[model samples]
Target: MKLPVLSLLVLVASCATPGGDAPATPAEMAAQARTALVHVEQPDPGSPLLQVDTAAIADSVDDAKARALLAPLLSQIADLSLARTHVSVASADWLLQCQSLRRLDVRACSRVDDAFVRAIVALPQLEELILARTATTDASIDALLASASLKRVWMWKSAVTPAGLARLAARDGLLVDAGLRPSDSSAEVEPKPEFVNLLPMPGEPALDAALVPINVNCPVTGAPVDAKRTRTVNGRVVGFCCNNCPKTFDADPAKYEAALPKP
Candidate 1:
């Protein structure tokens, strides 16, 4: 007797591979993670079961989701971006397990603070970190300073003060990006030069001209520097995005000077 369509479908489904509903393997977990909107890279398609090399869960991933999604692939993840997630210090335990993690981006994860930074800095291979818009302060800077493998840290918009940035920048080869340079008009000021030269001199390479600011963004506001608004400070030219930024720099030169490229 011929079976009904539903029965036939069930029969076929029953005959399918065993363990189909069993616990997922690492590769399967990666596929499932991807389905949940986590961006994962296997790096080598030829090896179908290869572990994921990179994973970005920039969505609203909290501590529980972070643990669930990353636990299976922690060993292989080299680059991870948790930017904009809701993860907090509770997720740091799993992040610390990412032994191979080289770069991490937790930018905009407001819940992440100095405690989280302290934990992740222990990752032996962590090299670059992006912590912009978080609550981390100078304590985070102190934790980051102890990381032997860290080469760059972007902490713009955090609580790190200019003094904190200077301390971190003092570390050789460590790049520190502390949001817009701070300025206080009330702070003690230096005498402005009677005549400041803003133009590149003849026969000078524009790229290397002393009047050309080494940074493309205004040190005071982190905005695109306007070539016309330039000032010579300590023999180096500094550029500002607007007339007001130069004034801001003039008010407190030392605070902004740390943001300029080191001599």
Candidate 2:
């Protein structure tokens, strides 16, 4: 009796045969996605300018897959535009590969840090660097100053200090935003409460008056007391040296309460 071979064929097709082509690797899948992104050409070889809108891929792929796919392609890229994405330090290998890179925009990439700044210094052709709304701190400022080719750096909302900006301004033509708190011209100055004047003990730095009332270090991070940035727990004000310190303290205020002075 001749059985229908069509059923057998359908069964074989439904089952993924091992001998048949294997599935595409993560890197390969990423490469296919990357090829569709906006590509702008420059006078350099291999069309060095690459604009990666990672925001487009964020929903589709995790960070590892994206890095594996894009890292190899950055070897010849000169200009990389990464807006609104977390570029982790593990991807440093690919960024450092851009030897001819001139302009880099990392706006709103909070994951970027001082190490990224140090790595980019190797790019001799780098001229304009935008690091707005990043976690980059004073640690990267000296490296920026040392760059012979860097012209303008925009670091608005970065952790850079006023002192660091002053040093950068001393350079002949380098431009940097002050990132200073905007003053309200229309607002009238309110008189300080008597308690405010009474808070500071005699013979301390004037700036200390604005810091939290703590003689000892922060129990959480061991940072010096900060008068300006504080959190009140159990009807007592506690000082924190860094912006994130209070968060650490708040996770379990009871744990650090013993370390704090009586209010």
Worst 10 residues of 2 by lDDT: 1-10
Give the Cα-based TM-score of candidate 2 against the true structure.
0.50
lDDT of each: 0.75, 0.64
Error of 1 at 254 (Å): 62
TM-score of each: 0.56, 0.50
Q: What lDDT score goes with residue 229 in model 1?
A: 76
Clash count in backbone of candidate 2:
4
In each prediction, how many residue pairs overlap at the backbone (N, C-alpha, C within less than 3 A)? 0, 4
Task: Point to the candidate with the largest TM-score.
Answer: 1
Question: Please, what are the lDDT tens digits per residue for candidate 1 over residues 1-263?
Answer: 12442353343333233655523566565665565556777665664322332234355467866666566667878888888888889988888888888888888889989999998899999899999999999998779999999999998998888899989999998998876555765776779854323456688655445556666778998877777777787777778888898788888989988877677
Q: How close to the true structure is residue 102 of candidate 1, measured as C-alpha lDDT? A: 84
